[model samples]
Target: MKYTVKGTQEEGVQACAKHFIGNEQETQRSNVIYPDGTEVAAISSNIDDRTLHELYLPPFADAVKAGVATVMCGYNRLNQTYTCQNSKLLNGILKEELGFLGYVVSDFYATHDGVPAIEAGLDMNMPGPWDSMTAAMTYLGGNNASLWGQNLTTSVGNGSLSEERLDDMIRRIMTPYFHLGQNEGFPSVDPSGYFITAVTAGYIQTSRGAPPARDVRGDHAKLIRRIGAEATVLLKNVNSTLPLKTPLSIGVFGNDAGLPADGMYVLGDDPPYPGVPRSGYEMGTLSVGGGSGSGRSTYVVSPLNALMARAKNFGGRVQYILDNALIAKGDFSTLYPTPEVCLVFLKTWCGEGTDRASFENDWNSTLVVERVASHCPNTVVVTHSAGVNTMPWAENENVTAILAAHYPGQESGNSIVDVLFGDINPSGRLPYTIPRREADYALPITNMTGDQSRNASAWQSDFTEGLYIDYRHFDAMNITPLYDFGYGLSYTTFEIVGTPSADLLQKELPPFPPSSQVEPGGIPGSGMKCSKSRLSSVTQDQSPAQLLCSST
Candidate 1:
């Protein structure tokens, strides 16, 4: 509703359906399909119809048809090519096919996504004063308008942006500007008046997105809760430390306990809550680099609250430790002279699609596990975070258990309790590799750059691993992630028929059902099975083996 109609008509703002083809969830937002919405867990693939119609492409189609005034270009590359500037999306489809006459906008700082966006037929590269080649061109003479024209004219001549391209883009924009009477603001007079109805010949456009049946703003919390519930997962349990079957005393630490709590969403408290740092510096600023709202986006849920909530359900009381003073120290003796299950909630946030600076949990997280192991024997770590991390904590034979709850939203506190108390199965997966450390990245390419092709690392960002960003790279390098991508655990086990056939792997997952589609769930972490199974290695350019299976 917001993207297609509410933001536009209700606010009188030109609603731009962003990321033309498919861009969502910045953690590895481009050139991938999270299938199940996990970024590190994405697979290299094209936009399938289920997504094209349901999730991926529809908004733009709707925008164009409904007479939306603009669309935004994506910052990341799609299929190894920049989308801000992909011609297939811009001139070919948005124009000739969809018949859109409105303008196109590049995402803030997406001038990189811009050149291709202009070639693709995007009209405005915004959050702009153009830079890079676009800036250089602007200095040369052509502003974005002329720079775009020059590039298109050149692309057509040299086969970069394309020639027939210039005319098609020009024609499309001109048609709306002139034929639509846009010369006089399309003669609608009032953007919200009766004139538009009379002039367009039809009030209901084929392209508009339908408004929600009701005001969902009231249920925003409910919606976020459901997403939290479904997305959370129990990753490990060495001795079955979860389901809090019996009532007992609890020991809690970290931000949840509050000696002096991190302001959270407020960013600058003890243990330090996350702040939106601009692209330029770590000092707090309103915007991150590229001048867009930082997606950290202000969400908070403390583990202590969740623990207390769960304990109440089972009839138990909880104690909080104040001050970093080792209430338990390396030993749980301070919290419990007698034994009780220790629960450590590790809250780690790596901006989406971006990998962590290190693969292991911080010393605090490890120390929590260390104390639990020394004193409480029965310990479980409920990690509330986004992305995956190699568990150095797992090294302790006594650590006992783990859970991967990817940024569960508002009701997150309550949801963790439900699952721990046996309400839900942790069915989530590690979206990317939990490599041992930064040095172990066979090519260490996940979330290395926020840019599409800017070279920043000592090792060149390798495209030799093209279309093979996730587990495929792992398989190729024969280097397994500490935790493999797509690794998820369920309360009940799922089995896939081991019918091995290479040819069969090429076939698509059974087409998405009418109501929903395949999110491409499962990776080697889930369990590895290949199509040509008798035993064989792969060569470069040859696809890292694929397996076709049936859930048995």
Candidate 2:
């Protein structure tokens, strides 16, 4: 967060911390009133105050302390009230408690009521006007699509909202704009290049002009390649099967190894209607995920492309089967003579607006890996995924190695080859626990059925797990995971020689934060303070608490 805000602001851009609080799931995120008169309320994240402060509020608090320029309230309700209009969250926690001077903006079409949201502390409604479908719904009295704009002005005029609150909103919205010196020489926005097209039902086209063709990728490709290589996580290696020595022949399989068959590297080329599943691998390499959070790259380098280039340079033979079905059928022996090594590339697509059905790999990738490993003794599995994926074949004798290459972006192929052929050592670690079975999680993705179904008057998602989530839940339940969090492998090894110790200098510590006046950035001297203490101790246990002060 510090790097993101400082780096972007240094380059004349503002970074925004988003999904304010308790937006855990995406099911029924937004309010909807169907043409058939059926209504689905936004899901409510019912969080206890202690759990909210301890678990969900730290990252956002850190982001505020880092002087982030903007904060976006999420679509879901926080404690049964829409986040944009939740007073305890936006006004109490964010604005007053954390001393966040930046304005609060709503997610796209997330605001429900103008007066309540403004009074609660929402400074801005994203993309003010409603789209055609929303406007039609509003006209039919099914929904109140536009929360601000003319309605906001009328609310203030009719005494439903106060002018003082409106002015405060304006002040908060402009504080960061001037503080960041955006008025001096901010770059002009090229709407044609960045604006969304209006061909879709829920989107309003901001500009009618054709988007200008531009290639703004300066030296980012080089940086991307280096990061990609460093981020590749080597999950398993048997008998040093990796670091390929320019084998005489290599066999590549899986649709993920190449571009999409339809040649659509980027999404949004086709209309985006709700419930219509976007083409995954059939569109190309899974460099990014799907939905609003997905990114766009000028080009994506698939693993097959990088392997073929390496093979050509080394005068080696390369054969590939990009069809998932053909590989899973286990009948490719005639087309593929046994090669020195076989590389199977797999991926799972996940993003905002939806949750994956399971942790299993998509496109029948588990079957593909089993079939390939059965035939090829020296099989190397490379997986690209957004999150945890169950590996049923990790213990197979034929599966010599496995690399968890999570979404390498445009340099996917080169980065994997770099780690595979010893050009780069894999150093990335898993961010979440990968359990042996889905049941091991204990805390399953909540299915709001019964009275809490989508058609119910209100959708409630109780945070029953509390602070015990992910690895913490595993530890509390004493369940062994398939691969623990932060689990990763490297070609080389290192060891610490000396014991670690810490000292506590301050005899007394304040239980609450300083009550300093709120400033543009934050409370003065509110940042954590640490120092060497007179009382010192050393322990062989080497827990992280032993190395740092409690204040830190």
What are the per-residue Cα lDDT tens digits for candidate 2 across 439-473? 88866655666555646446778897776787767
The digit string of per-residue lDDT tens for model 1 on 343-386 reads 66555534433434555543355665666566656667666554
Off by over 4 Å in 2: 131-145, 194-196, 199-209, 265-279, 448-455, 500-552
Each prediction's RMSD to truth: 13.0, 8.2
Alpha-carbon deviation at 208 in model 1, angstroms: 37
Best by TM-score: 2
Identify the runs in model 1 with alpha carbons over 4 angstroms from their true place.
1-104, 112-120, 127-216, 256-264, 267-301, 322-333, 352-355, 436-439, 445-462, 493-541, 547-552
Q: What TM-score would you give candidate 1 relative to the actual structure? A: 0.57
lDDT of each: 0.50, 0.75
Provide the TM-score for each candidate, comma-separated: 0.57, 0.85
Output the lDDT of residue 75, model 2: 86
